[model samples]
Target: MKMNMFGLFNKKKSDTVSLPYTTDIHSHIIPGIDDGSPDVEHSVALVKQMQEWGVKRIITTPHVTEETFENTPETITAAYNLLKEALGEDAPEIIFSAEYRMDENFLKHVKNDILIPLPGNHILIENSFLQPFWDLKGLIYQLQLKGFNPILAHPERYAYYYDEKEIYTDIYNSGCMFQLNWLSLAGYYGKETRNIAYWLIEKGYVDFLGTDLHNRRHARAITEFLQTKEYRKLVEKLNLKNDTLK
Candidate 1:
């Protein structure tokens, strides 16, 4: 991934920038889970890193895709327990949730009421890159009827929707919230994602800002981004909904 001169500057901040949120509501830090930490030690390390970045709590979200991850509540809980045990007493508060993909299996789980949600019944959902879900609007309505507030994770990363901003507006109008990946602002993904992220922020459409932290590399990027002036301004300007999870 290419980054600008600002993102390349990695010196530790002389003055602290107060993080906007007391809690980070999205991540993949549970050990041995999906594509996140490979082991307990790495999971603990990531948690500590987030703590240093001023996040008081984290709700790690593992992928629960049908074809790939296929994670269940039982599996996620076991992993969370293992991570919690490894952290001992000094670690910040940790919670567990799943980033659900809108597929047949997800619909089954939704109907079964087996989904785990954030503090406010907020359930994170993502789309496939191949194509948008055909009934996304209806699905959001159904999720709301089932008492789950669906949050679209990293909407900027969906390149297909970039051509039409109204699609995002329609999704939001359907009662689904948007979560902006913190890495997007650092150009960790690319310039297109970065531009879309800022555009969403400018339109007051961003409801949450998440680390989406998977491993050390992503952690380092977030740490570097936080050191820059732009990141601090975003923290103030967006007024992200992460505080609601606290």
Candidate 2:
């Protein structure tokens, strides 16, 4: 269980810094459930890496898309239990929820009240990348009516809303909180996504910061970015709610 021997943690203590927030609200570390870790071994490695990076608790959110992941509570729980068993006492505190796509399937879950939420009843949701969801505001209102706090996951990655930036404000005003992907700030997606990430920070629209980590490549990029001056500055400017989730 010597997690420090893995990844960037092997660097000199002065050369590396722990994440500001102890609770990581978004990640894909659950094994074999979605596009995250492929199995229990990979999940253990990823969790150990996060532990070295100062993550005390992980709220691993697997994708619950309609046609793609189609994850159910039973499936997610089984995978989560497997991961926990593999890690034993060496693992960081782990909880399981799902990143729900805003679609008919999710609406059905809402109707059935089967959706898993983060601490404080906050639910992470995403929009279709190909196009904006119609009546997204209404959907947010519906979630709110059902007593769930809906947080739009990685708003910067949605290219359709780039030109119509006013929609961002509209969505915020409609009471949907925004979660910014930490990798987006590292320019992992591209220049446009980085720009929007900063833009959200400047406008004070970003309420939560998530790793959105999918693999080892993402872990390396995020680890490198964490030590940069830009990352330091960005965190100072952000009023993130990640700690509140604990």
Candidate 3:
């Protein structure tokens, strides 16, 4: 995909990769390979959008599920190369990670050395947003055993877990880190999700923040959110310790 799709701006070196949104660790902007930024051009648009928002480092994570999109390292490698070509070396640092679907198949993959580990042994993980995991406790136990910390993506969007507050505490105590999506805070995922996002922030339950930018619609939402007092409060309150981010 060409960077022309979203039209990269002609900015100075210092302006190009400034840290307005220092670390965006979760995104589906890896192009047409998953249920995300469509094609290479679309993915470029997503990254460029993030770059404009002051995101210096982007860890683009596509979905890896058992029923669908059964992504492996080989599959991610090819896409990563293509994405690298699209972004060029001068672009902001782009890393590869996967938002793993914590399903029955996940256990097997984790055991068989098929799962991709996030930098520093951090693994981005997601459960069904519609339903709570049937055996969530056991799954969390397995993740701990694998020596990887599971970072749950968009916990606010999970309908079932929002009602059961204990599930959040359980997951937190289970040693799973939580990430909140930018759009969720902007009410793009609906009011319920917005409430949950704020609740996590207010209660100090969130560990990290992400763009989760898949397309222009999400891009616009995040752009607007970054300007809000609420977004400022969330980040300033957290003072997240993502040292590798520039």
| Candidate closest to the true structure, highest lDDT | 2
How much does each candidate deviate from the true structure in C-alpha RMSD? 4.9, 2.6, 3.3
lDDT (10s digit) by residue, model 3, range 12-76: 33433232357788888887778887778777767777777777788778888877888888888
How much lDDT does each candidate structure score?
0.85, 0.88, 0.76
Ranking by lDDT: 2, 1, 3
Q: In model 1, what are the clashing residue pairs, if there are any? A: none
Best by TM-score: 2
Give TM-scores for every candidate, taking all chains together and pairing residue i with residue i. Answer: 0.92, 0.94, 0.88
lDDT of 1 by residue, 52-81 (tens): 678888888999998888999999999999
TM-score of 2: 0.94
**Models ranked on TM-score:** 2, 1, 3
Compared with the true structure, the alpha-carbon lDDT of candidate 2 equals 0.88
What value does the lDDT take at residue 209 in candidate 3?
81
Between prediction 1 and prediction 3, which has the larger lDDT?
1
User: Per-residue alpha-carbon lDDT of model 2 for 1-246, expressed as tens digits?
Assistant: 653324533454455568878899899999998999897877887887787678899998999998999999999999999999988987788998899998989889999999999999999999999987888989899989989899999999999889999999999988999999889999999999999989988989999988898888888888889889987887789788898984
